[model samples]
Target: MRILVSNDDGIFAEGILALIRAVADLGEIVVVAPDQQGSASSHGISLHRRLVPKPVDLQIQNVEAWSFSGTPVDCVKFGVTQFGEQHPFDLMLSGINEGRNLATDVLYSGTIAAAGEAALQGIPALAVSLDGPPFPFDEAAQVVRKMVDRLQFKTLDADTFLSVNIPAESVDGPWVVTRIGAEGYRDRFIRHTDDDGQAYYRYVGDVVRNIEDDDSDITVVNKGCISITPLRYRFTNEPAMDTLKTWF
Candidate 1:
């Protein structure tokens, strides 16, 4: 299967390189990633400034790659729609992100957004992330390789993909399918002004387990297990539909 690989962490990131190397034998890999760290950029796209993509010779692992001055979603959309038709891809892989994309964090994650965009385009995709900063990517890459080997691509429904999160250690074991948790970040944002009087707001928050009994991505990662959450484009509140209808 031809695979399109992209990331929020840019092409030079060790995590992306590791993922590329691990999945090299699977099929043709085409990488189009952000020119710089897009990190928690979410599904944002560059609208005002012109997106500049330049061919890069990052022969580190000899993966065909390009760098785009855009968001992670832009990378995937541009790569598949603009570049992939010349050499079509059967699937898309985003990240091996530096941090875990759990719970509401996925909403703010450019890594997950890349996969989300691919899914929107009817391509099966996966978003892989590591739990902590300064984590070893080789370990996570190995897990990806193993998962890929054991996976059956046909089992996935149309326009769906998996979100994988690995614990902050070298683990050789089975993965656990889990639900996205309800836990969330605390402390909120910190806004300030710079010396030049430019206003700035930083999202400075820590993960908080507020519920005494809550099943979420936050708790799953805390228990040191690989979390595999099957995700889709649909967002519905079946239980709350009646309540919402009453207001109408």
Candidate 2:
């Protein structure tokens, strides 16, 4: 299998390197990732600016890598359209990210966005993240490698992808399939004055609240089990559309 790898943590990050090491024996690997971290960039593409992709020497045996001066989504776009056109990737794997993208946090994650971009192109994809202050990247990568090996047997919808979160410490049990959690971090901003007396707001809030659902991603991860949440790009509210039809 030919696999395309990308990440929001940039190409030189230890997480990505660990990911490459874990899956190197599986198949041919090509990496296209951001030169700098694009953490909460979501699925943003560089529409107005010119994207520059430069060849990077990772010195990893049997892996060709490139660093793009754009977001994680841009890396996926370029990797699929350019390199994939030549080699034809069987799967696209993003991250082994430095931190967990749990619950609604995936909505703001560039790591998950990269995988989403690949799924949009009809390629199978998965985003891997580790919940951490001290990230256990090797363990996370091992989990991801096993998942990748078994992905061929699983069936997913055209625009669907998987978002995986692993505990930084040893897991208590086996991995669990979970639903996306409705819970998220409460938005809070701190008002501050600059040295020049200019008032500004700084985003500061680490408090996360998870929904009561036991099958939710947040709940599952907190229980020390690896969470695998299947996600799709469709945002249409079908039930709402039927209710709104009466107004017309």
Number of the top-ranking candidate, with TM-score as the measure: 2
Inter-residue clash pairs, candidate 1: 181-216, 181-217
TM-scores of the candidates are 0.90, 0.94
lDDT (10s digit) by residue, model 1, range 184-224: 77877888999999999987888786662334556666777
For residue 225, what is the lDDT in candidate 2?
89
Q: Evaluate all candidate structures by whole-model CA lDDT and list the values in order.
A: 0.83, 0.89
Q: Where is model 1 more than 4 Å wrong at Cα? A: 60-62, 191-193, 196-201, 212-215
Q: Give the clash count for model 1.
A: 2
